[model samples]
Target: MPEYIHGGDVYSHAERYGSLPLDLSANINPFGIPERVRQAMHAAVEDCTRYPDPFCRAARQAIGRAEGVPPDWLYCGNGAADVLDRLAAVLHPQNALLTAPTFAEYERTLAGASITFHTLREEEDFALTERLLADLTPEREAVYLCNPNNPTGRTIAPALLDEIVRRCAQNGTWLIVDECFGDFLTDSAQHTLRAQLGTNPRLILLRAYTKMYAVPGVRFGWCMTSNTALIEALYRAGQPWNVSVIAQACAAAAAEETDFARQTALRIAAERQRLRQELSVRGMAVCAGEANFLLFRAQDTALDRKLAAHGVLIRSCANYRGLGAGWYRTAVKTGADSERLLQAIDEIREDG
Candidate 1:
């Protein structure tokens, strides 16, 4: 059987162990769902009898104010993955460029295209350098980048990113940068390409409230681009009721929680540092990442299963491209949860 590409298998863990695991597998918000967002979702239940707004007007307006983009430049989808499906349907790219070990959803969306994986070297700590520019040729029609990438969790350097955008624009390659996890960063502005978005209509910036708001089940994500033509096409291509009423309400309410977002970022930064220090002190090869999660390597063993015995779960990166056994990704959760995961690993190491 094919392995699960993503994480958060609490259901399976419970089925096996007869209880839920401390699921750090999915890199969701450590604080869990916000009360305001929860209330919004609950309140939205009454609106379910009515069909959702096909255009998601109110939600987009709130998102626009939070993201500093005109709602016209934004297009909502069920989730980032659903938006990606729309992208795949719209842009029939025969040749694509993607980095190794980035988000798996990109490859799934860009399937059937001749994909060139620019492998991020482990020696260089999986950083996307200027060398990727060499692959942004005229033949490559599509490119996807995960800022503070999924498992590695490292944001690409700003200058290198700008050069990539320029190269893609020059080659007329469609560029999609997944900044879903950007909100977890303390200075997400520094790493984002939002400044150049006005000049580059072909550049698609995807963001989601799933991670930061801890509403993965809510399925709220949107993409921003200056290309009005592309926007219309994506909207028309997607279902008229692409985003549910609950999701729209969550998006709008979550956008208004600026103070909540700020506090989460500060909390994540502290926990991430603590996790890094603890992992390194335990002799793990922790990557240099500034996101709400850390990817590290331990001595090759059944760490996932071992941790599971202790009712803990972490994302195993064996299936991710350019990575193999012994590599794992764990979310920087709250102090208690983080402590449980570390304690489990320490016990396992000592047992050996």
Candidate 2:
């Protein structure tokens, strides 16, 4: 069997441990899919027999309008993972640089292309600095950056990201920023590099609908780049009907639901703050995560084992590249779920 990377491996573990618990491993929206989105999916059910639009024309247009980028500049995929794989196939860089303890998929995709990859250590709470960029090899072909990065939930400052983009462009290196969790940030537009897409031909911005709309099953995501040529290349490499008919309609509807998006942002902000305060009171060393999750270092491995035993699963980051034992990540769920998780952690602390 393949090595299990993160949480949600409950099925394999469930065989040994019995029924799976509430999965907090994946950084998904705790609110789940909205009622409007579910209704849209039911309405789209009749279109299943017809093949989904190869271009995802309506969906792409909606996303383009919402994001202020032209439809031609966007390339939709099964998920951001699909876009990353296609990117690897087309770019096939000989060397890539990524932050250690960031998203695992970037490394996994790079490995599949037989590329040499290096990681920048996350000393100082996984923060990125100008000095880190200075260490990149002149021969390096590309760099993968995850904003409000996974596991650690640390975001690169806007000024720093601008400097990195400028430096990468000057060095003739491709800079792919995976902002899948960017939506979780309060001022997403301020930190996002989307507006600078046309300024730097070497930049590729990846965005996803999974976490924001709570529709991972739909597998909708897109890559934004000013390089029309690169966008065309990715489009050609993508499989036809990569996104299902229902998914396309659902994605289109979700993109247009501005009110829903606003409400989600507010709810997440409040819940995240509440979770942070509660965890702090419990004495867990929590990181000030900007995303919809809080990353904390448990006092010991006993906390992780105890939480799982209570049927409340959270990500244990021991498997990540640079993280060690005691690292755990949990999503900001509904108020009730949050309370349940807090209760579970309290129990663990009491027992320990």
Candidate 3:
């Protein structure tokens, strides 16, 4: 069997649970695909006979306009993972620093490149501090940071991030910030590093269309960097026509659907707060974060087993570098789905 990545193990969930129930482990939009994006994709299906635009010109232009970056600085990929792998190839850092329990892909991609890695401890709740910044040396070639960090669901303060960026620039270290979940932030622009790309050549920002658009099957994602040289290296290293025609069309439409994006963000924020309140009222200790997911400690491993038995699969963080059996992460799903999970947890507590 293939190893589990992160989040809802679809194959395992289907096999053990009989059928897929509400999958709250993957942090995707609960509302599913938007009508506009679906329509656009369906319309583009007719062009499948022809090859996709290798350059992704139109999609890149749309992304550039939406992100306020030059089109030349953007490069689309099959998914964020593809871009990450390419980054690993081009940067080829000898030593890298990453937050423990952040997205596992950073380490996996770096490991494949034979890169040495250092992990920040979890006692600080995996938060990046000034002392942590001072520990980085010139030998550490690159640093990967996931804002509103995964698994833990915590965010680094903006000022601290600025300081880190400054330090990285001074030491000639590449700072790659994965803002895959940054769209869920109330003030995305304030927290985003895209605007500073030109001024800080050391910074690379990774964005994804999968999570917010609920289009993981389509695999649409891109990376932005002001260094034209790095962008060229990535483009050359990636396969030709990496993104599909349908994915390109759908991702562009989703990016243009400003209203839908705003509504979804608002809905997720409200729903996340509601879920946190409901869980806390039931005696669960939830970790605070800005994304559309919640991380909390279950009373025991029994809760994990019971939830799985009930067909509600959540991410058990035991496999994460710094987490253990009691750690659990669940995405903010629809009102009904969230209620179902809460009810299941309540029942498990009562039974215990």
Candidate 4:
């Protein structure tokens, strides 16, 4: 398996620091899980003895209604990562293209394939631009685009994204755009490619309940594409009941909480701006992002470990390709949680 050491390792931090730390590592919803979703999961415990619907009919139907996609177009997986793994298995592309300093799972899932990196220059603030269209050559059979890209949290402009999609189609490249963090954006619809799935057989869109619903333990995510044959191949790549009954139930309920998602986007917009300004004033090179997290650089390369001592956890982006040490990512938490995070950083290390 690919390295699973990404983040949200509060347990590991607790073990080493001798105390549980507030996790600002994972960009989970600050509002926590919706009450209806929590209750749905609880109500599903009794149904655990029965086999979950292999097709995820009920969950997909509920999610379809919310996401405005047909249930048949959806392919539920253990998580977005799991869907990506199955996708890699089914496509088995000889050559893949992805952005550097984005999600590492793209590299891990396509490990066997020859990979090409389109480095997003830091001087460009890591934002994807028209320059990327040049890399969509015929030689690359598959491509991964992480919207509001991880670590950088910068999204591609719509016109640029359209051109990239057009280029991918011309090259006959299978395009998988990951919009897992789309819910956190104030205008997520602008960044989403859901409307194109019906026309673009080569396009696939991925979404997850992990970050938006704060349900990582459920390991629930789904991908939507109009390519029926590809969807069938994905099912064959994995075993039956890949998603548990509880997870399906949670996904179904969570999909119905549309207002919850809306409020979260609003709150995240405010909180992210607050943190971005604060971090920049503190002498860090903060990337302007609209997501629920901030990616910034610091003089303290060991900042993550140092914060652990003060009962807080943050992600060190040193392992992310195209980035080096001193780069870090922290979730924009609600209320005083962000205050505590800032205070912890102040206590442990000098600002810049």
Model 2 segments beyond 4 Å from truth? Answer: 10-20, 112-123
* Model 1, span 1-352: residue lDDT tens: 6666798879889999999999899988878788999999999999999999999999999999988889999999998999999988998788988899888988988778899999998899988888887888898898999998988998999989989999889988899999999998898889988878899988999999999999988898999999989999998785799899999999999989868877898998998898899999999999988898889998955898899889999988888999999999998889999899989988998898
How well is each residue in 1-352 modelled by candidate 4, as lDDT tens digits?
A: 5555688988777677677788899988877889999999999999999999999999999999998988989999999999999999999999999999899888888877899899998899989988888889999899999998998889889989998888898888999999999988889889899888888999999999899899998999999999989989989998988999999999999888868888889988888888888888878999987788889999988998888878888899998899999999998888688899888878775544
For candidate 3, write residues 108-171 as lDDT tens digits: 8887443443454555655666766765678778999898788766778889888888889989
Residue 136, candidate 4: C-alpha displacement in angstroms: 0.8
Clashes by residue pair, model 2: none
Error of 1 at 322 (Å): 0.3
Instruction: Judge candidate 2 at residue 184 and give its lDDT.
Output: 79
Off by over 4 Å in 1: 1-3
Model 3 misplacement above 4 A? 112-125
Per-prediction CA RMSD (Å): 1.2, 2.1, 1.8, 1.5
Positional deviation of residue 144's Cα in model 1 after best superposition, in angstroms? 0.6
How far residue 44's Cα lies from its native spot in candidate 2, in Å, is 1.6
Q: What is the C-alpha lDDT of each candidate?
A: 0.90, 0.83, 0.83, 0.89
Of the pair 3 and 4, which is ahead by lDDT? 4
Error (Å) of candidate 4 at residue 302 is 1.0
- lDDT of candidate 2 at residue 288, scale 0 to 100: 78
